[model samples]
Target: MSQDYDKILKENIEALILPLADKLLGLSLGRLEEIPDDIQTTLERRPDFLKRVISSNSHESYILHLEFQVKDKAAMLNRMLLYYAMLKEKYGESIKQYVVFMGRRKPRMSTQLKEGMIDYRFSLVDIHQLDYRKLLDDATQPEQAVLAILSNFKKSEVDTILPEILRKLQALTNNERKLRRYVRQLEILSNLRDLQKETIKHTEAMPITYNIEDDIRYQQGIKYRKRQRRKYRGNY
Candidate 1:
């Protein structure tokens, strides 16, 4: 169950990066570039999303490192410092780092490290603190609409927003295949905010189409079974 939840969380966060980078980073980005994910520290620690974005104003480019967290972890600040050191070593550019907490509870994680001669810090944001209406108002991007469910939406607004979000997602897609994928993503993200029932209720009325095989979780299950079969056959 934990694994399934983590998978959904990862997919939801990744899907929104393209559409919500500016909002997430609080900067108007000109051109967004994905950095290679294989960069590792000497100790073999891999960091999360590392991006190169050009500032909308000034036209200057910088590195944006983002780490998404569902719960507070011990020594997270140390980990971020390690990642920052490794990233600075490789890119040789100014790197701005941020940690986005997706959990419903208030974040208690440390965002800075202050000791003798070493002062390091990074920005921390909680998704629930953000205003949901901003995302709901963005009609051009379906990703924002989907993410708005996890934001600070009032309980009274759920009925109205959920249906509208589903309608917008369906209209954004051109074919049944794409529509299903979006719906599946919406379902997964809604679960994070404990609105799975509302999501199902709204999506059922829409003409969204999806295949079991097209879903990533289903595909992963198939791969896991294949690996298990291969191992059993070898033992036989």
Candidate 2:
């Protein structure tokens, strides 16, 4: 992933909801107890999504682990395997791991490792392959509704889908300030699909306003990203 998209990913990690986790990542979990994800024992990085969730089907407790992957980097499986081991040691519970790939290209990275005496694998899903409408259909809150931006939708449908998402956000969140944050999130995630312009146009049309000049993500972090063209692109 480029630096710009990576920044967007970091910004949205906390915002990405469990409804996305359950559907996109295929984990039927309930009553999640979020645990600290920053357990950097040997590696310098932390897991993107880590929580103790009760299995909705079995009614058992286990660790639900998920990661948002934008790039098919080398040694990706190695990193996940490492995470599995670290999380297993810490939590001592059965684990479920998944990687939600949101990059432009098809994912080429291997998801399993079958060594001489070991067999390990993790679930990998491409966000573009899922149905965007179904995501909104399952969404019960504004946070879940905003994630529809990352799911599969056509170029012509940008005007349609984005507006629906904004409307859902408006209906769910009676708070204007909260709606603006989801607008900012959609603006950032739309770049991964190369639909930033359309996202901003419809978002600007909404009743709530998203002030890019005041948003710290727009001013400080996304400043050097030249590919993400907008009205404020040249201002900073």
Candidate 3:
């Protein structure tokens, strides 16, 4: 992943993580306390998110560990097991582990490992398999709104999808400066799905006003459009 992508993920994961925990994992979290992710053991390992959550209904509390996986690594199960051991030893509480797969391709990572009398597993959710509309509607923050693109929206045309995303983002954001930042985040994530150009095109058609000349991304997009015009003329 590019540094920009990593930066976006690190910054905006809080928006995506909680909702996924609630809707997918069925974690009826009443209280979610951020736990220190740095585990100091034989090997130092840091998880993406570690939280102590109390169930709203049952009043049960446990350690919830969620990893945002961009690639399908075969050793993911082993890695989770290691983190499981470290967290269990440190916290001495019930631990639930989940991996949120965000890659464009199908995930082939194993979620469970078993031995005689030893059973271990982690929940794996392919983000693309989720309904994008539901995810978008559930989004409370602009950061979360941008992530709806990463979810399952292939059933809908890109023509149809990008506008709604931008519109929802427009409704959620009041600050132009923050809106530009969120647009950049959306642009970067859209690249993963090969929809950056469409995202820009849809934004151009939308009514939201912003200084495109002031933004490097829009400027490059403008140049690309000009190039396309020249190419079409030359072809004719």
Collision pairs in model 1: none
Among all windows of 10 consecutive residues in model 1, the one with the lowest summed lDDT is: 1-10
> Which candidate number would show the highest TM-score if scored against the true structure?
3
Error of 3 at 67 (Å): 0.4
RMSD of each: 4.1, 5.3, 7.0
TM-scores, in order shown? 0.78, 0.80, 0.81
TM-score of 1: 0.78
lDDT score for residue 208 of model 2: 60
lDDT of 2 by residue, 84-128 (tens): 988888878898888888887889999999999989999888988
Model 3 Cα lDDT, one tens digit per residue, 95-139? 988998877788999888898987999989887776787888888
- Order candidates by lDDT, high to low: 3, 2, 1
Model 3: residues with Cα > 4 Å off, grouped in runs: 40-45, 204-236
lDDT of each: 0.74, 0.77, 0.80
lDDT of 3: 0.80
Any runs in candidate 1 off by more than 4 Å, and if so which?
1-15, 41-45, 56-59, 210-236
Error of 2 at 31 (Å): 2.8
